[model samples]
Target: MNDTFTEADLAPDPQEKRDRLLAVADRVAALVAVLAGGVYIGGMIALGAGAAPIVFSMLPRSIAGDVMGAIFARFDAVALGAALAVLAAEVTRMVAARRRGRTILSRLRRSCTLFMAVCAAYVALSLSPRINDLHRQGVQRDDTPQGQVLEAVHKRAELFGKIGMGMAFGLVVLSVFTIQPRRAEDEEDDDEAAAPLPPGPRDD
Candidate 1:
């Protein structure tokens, strides 16, 4: 008995498979980054758009502070988790890309993602605690000089949080664009390949 297999019958090349998997992973990272950005932007907007102030004014100040603080804590928790996931995914993609042949764009993207992740971590862990401490002290005795200083510090931290969040949002947008398939390049290649054959010499 004789057996024969054609090219289509053979398994895909291992390297080709690896390349496809890496591409899929990169796409997933891009998607996660975009979704995480949306979540973060929404939470930031809710906090910055006077939602806390409105709620505080409607209730006893103490109760308002506690509730708002709890809400912010929950937001921070979610933000931190999401940021970690994004960072891990981005790092994985960067390493994979470098193994192949790192481009300038890939390096820039990795740096941007790392900076965004660090910003998110700092905001959640360090800045949040400082803001909370300052707010608590200010609210306890805001008429006093110490309380006034506390209030100023809280405001400054809040400003920093806004700037950090804005940067993170921008970086996420850039990453999304960076990971998108180069459709224009692909189209150009196709057009070149499909160009009409030059007119053949007419038969005598």
Candidate 2:
């Protein structure tokens, strides 16, 4: 009996190895996107619904504003980071899916992801700083000009926050309902490949 291993036998198939790596990367990207999105959504809900009301009820308006402002300021960094993570993960997943000849996310999913990132950037980069500056300047009275300006800016910020939260919720829903299961997708591809082609015109 001959005991010999050829170079071809010793080496793994490059295509197979590449597919395996791509599969692993795809899973990782999906997991990262989900985790990051969850953190972003949970944080938004907590700050908006749970923390703000409680803090305002317990503390004076001015003090509560300051406290909430500070909390939001800290969370801005987190929100921005989480948003970036989600965007990166989704882009990675998109690339992986394209390589595999699969559709991982729909157009709506991509749009929502982009919108979420934009909203986070706007809040963190534009709105948060303005709010913080107003807080620092100290709005003495709600009726005064400075106070009114602060109120307007604060209201606008809240509006965007609420919009962002809604977008996040919609994204979660779309992800759950729209994304096809990998197994189902694979089976679909198999079915198509297995399907018989229409009979060619009979040769004379």
Candidate 3:
């Protein structure tokens, strides 16, 4: 019995394995980015279209504002988390794309994801705190100066939320279109083409 290993057998296998792993990672990252963006968009819609009206209609204005304010504060945390997840997933996909020798990082996609993150962070860190402070100060009425200021700030927050949701939706769409996994056979074919042919049997 003879045991021998050729360079051809060992050299190509590691690179092929690496390509396959990166492809799988890319797909997972794309899926995660899309799902996270969807969650953020859905939460915003549910809060604005469903919860706000019902809560305000059922409870007194002041109490409704308080309840909704609390919910919004909690959801700000959720939005920030979703944004971070999307950004992380996008970064992973970019790395995989670079490794695969493809340009999967579209500028529009990056811009949209970044815009979403910025809007979420702005609302969560900057605007939400102001709104919460106003709520705590019992400024629910819309007629007085402080109440008017609260209303203005609340409107601004709503505007930012809408913008963030729009960006999130756009990011999801761009990700679906841009970030795709290469077929396994395609990677294998590429690897085979790049690899050196096995040494032909010598004839004397």
Query: Largest lDDT belongs to which candidate?
Result: 3
What TM-score would every model get versus the actual structure? 0.73, 0.76, 0.82
**Candidate 1 lDDT, tens digit per residue, 13-57?**
787577667777778877777777677767778886768879878
| Ten-residue region with minimum lDDT total, candidate 2 | 97-106
- Candidate 2 residue 53 Cα shift, in angstroms, is 0.8
lDDT of 2 by residue, 1-204 (tens): 757877777454787576556667767776676677778889989999999999999999888888988999999999999888878876876776564434444566667778888888899889878877888787743899998888888788888887777766666665555433455655665797799567888657
lDDT agreement with native, every candidate: 0.69, 0.76, 0.86
CA error at residue 45 for candidate 3, angstroms = 0.7
Show model 3 residue runs off by greater than 4 Å. 1-12, 99-105, 181-204
Q: Order of candidates by TM-score, top first? A: 3, 2, 1
Clashing pairs in 3: none
- For each of the candidates, give the backbone clash count: 0, 0, 0
Error of 3 at 135 (Å): 1.2
Model 3, 1-204: lDDT tens per residue?
Answer: 557876765554777778778878878988998999999999999999999999999999989988988998999899999999999987887887774435444767888999999999999998889988888888875789998899888889989999999999999998888866577777787898899677998676
What is the total number of backbone clashes in candidate 2?
0
lDDT, candidate 2, at 4: 86
